[model samples]
Target: MTLEALERRRLGALIWREKRAEAPGKEPLLRAIAAFLRRHGLDMLEFPPALEALRARLQFVRRHEPDGGWPDWSESGILAGIEGILDGFLPERFSKNILKQIDFQAALKAQLTYDRRRRLDELAPEQLTLANGRSFRIDYSAENPVMAAKLQWFFGVRSHPALLHGQVPLTVQLLSPAGRPVQITTDLPGFWGGSYKLVRHELRGRYPKHDWPENP
Candidate 1:
């Protein structure tokens, strides 16, 4: 028998809460209803980590550079955000099995207007270029947000990289020729003037074949 719209929604929310709290494998009908609830505005699942990381980058910018336009990630804020993004975009009825087909990243991106998205990319880019023109991904999940690359590539670098419009400094993890982590610092000039000399002296003996420039 077909349930009324309200009845389906109530059952869907209950089942969804239960499924998240415990084991999976609910009936197809219930799952369908739960998926329907999600498509609507009743979804209560925790935000996915990937989406959260994206939001974290935006939040980092907002926190450090408070003058920009960024979304609030609080419970009410996100519900409103989802509602706004999913507007006129949901189908009337779809199977629960296709729930995973939703492009959540796209939905999150939709929350930001084109200009803001462009601003976001500029302020917190996924990858950054080094002195040697090599691009490396930035780890936003790190305590201070780090970029790791071989020390040799930073030969001409005199200043540490900054993010969030220069409000935050990126922690750099320099690696050896063999990709072994050699040093971690946020001050490139300090390392080059002070510790780099000692490090160069030590590593040169161990890695005789690799050129460790004295001026780097």
Candidate 2:
């Protein structure tokens, strides 16, 4: 749904809650949460998936571990947030499933990934030249407002953290002094691990429309 529609729905839900009306549905709460996150730079077009994730997450929160102390409830604000949606929607049957599925180890692994994703800051240069001889770079950091705009246009980008998570490729060469990538490296993100070269191969092999380099 459109951002504006989401905003309206979320606000409507909030007003209803303040007035002691029935709590809002999941969609509205998700939208409210998504909208609020956007204010802080979440950059997503929609957060429908976060609803399921949050549901699974909340169950984990209430669990009692072996230690006498239960888990800290620090993130209750975030949970409480976008939570009005769960007013009546947090299903009962889903409890067993959510508790079972929330493997802390698995969740920990996922959190690590999310942490790496969060660490991804925009490139300092946004564009660079490897050798400057038959080479150019789009660092995705510097004066790449145009590049950022293009991302928003083609990939629905809105936040400074677009290039992370391998979600969308920051298209360069076409927009930069270099119209083709001499060498593309995804190593820095580490999430891409060693797949940068393979990604290059795929670029050349798959979407020829973008004119990926075959030689390098």
Candidate 3:
């Protein structure tokens, strides 16, 4: 009763093509595609080498892991991304048939490029300008984006720098004159109003030449 691997793959492809022709809409087609893959097993379904490469690249970019160390692509992630693109960006009249006819690699490349640009605009930034007119580059790859700067660089700033459209605060890595991290905090005001004096006391004797203003 079991089908051969080749037979299963052919069946999967045939079912996919038939589902597209039959259902045509995004949601319905996605459901059909998911069912087809699940029933036949994705390993048996041979995708074009170029198509697979594009899919992997798209997944990698979307996950923000450009270092080529991304984990293996999961079925759910691929399915979700496909549904997202079909529903969000594509025209309402767009359907699975277009996927068959179009230059998918080119289309996917354009989509990935646009998405990367949009995310860079929205979530990540190279530098944050403090109230003191000092700009520092932020490391967005970290779980919490970090900005390592000299304590003096933040002297005039009373509040923590906000990022991610002013919703999330940056983790400030306050460095000493010798470029050592003296304090790490996300709450600038709390550190300035409380622990800063204690730290100033400890560091003043070691770095007597550096300015440590009482009010800053």
Candidate 4:
């Protein structure tokens, strides 16, 4: 039977009670139920970092563009509507071992209409293209969105990129060859002209193979 039909009839609790009555003890039944819930991605354990970051980006867009049709991805909002989100997405008679393989993002995306889903991509892009045509992932988990990329990738880029239609400026984290943050700044032009000289001088000797141009 469909999950909706089951909920409408309140059969879940009834079935649990019947199972408990037939079972020797509560532990086995409880464990079975927990396993079932976990397998279905309904256990409400902490979401992975990427999923949480997506949610945070959605929230950022919602705050900046109140009139936009973005839906709330907050904990309360999700909990209230997760049943509807999962209604038709669940497979029938799935094995517990495959629980971890479920794509929660796909399920969440399914909940949004086509237009709002497209808007989500436009407002909170997963990656931004650099001057050298390299795309780096944006870290939306920060107070302000930040993009960390190797310094060489942004060689000709003079201005810092903005999000939410230029309302929010993105912080850039220039990384060394070792993937360490050599510099962090919102003003890319000033950084390029000023401290970049000293940075280039220091890092040139350290990472000789990597490009540390004088005019970067």
Tell how far residue 61 is off in model 3, in angstroms. Answer: 12
**Local lDDT at 42 for model 2:** 23
Which candidate should be chosen as best, given TM-score against the real structure? 1
Cα-based TM-score, every candidate = 0.70, 0.18, 0.51, 0.69
Name model 4 segments beyond 4 Å from true.
1-50, 90-104
Q: Model 1: which ten-residue window has the lowest total lDDT?
A: 1-10
Question: Using alpha carbons, what is the TM-score of model 1?
Answer: 0.70
Looking at candidate 3, the ten consecutive residues that score lowest on lDDT are: 1-10
58-77: candidate 4 lDDT, tens digit per residue: 88898888777677787667
The model with the greater TM-score, 1 or 4, is 1
lDDT per residue (tens digit) for residues 57-140 in model 2: 322323422242322222443343333423333333322133232233333233324433333222222232232222223332
Model 1, 1-216: lDDT tens digits are 122222222464464332222222234334444444545643434467777778767776777666665777544556544545554344445433334544556766777888987888899988888666778888877557888988888899887888977778999999988899999999999999989998898789889998988887
Model 4 TM-score is 0.69
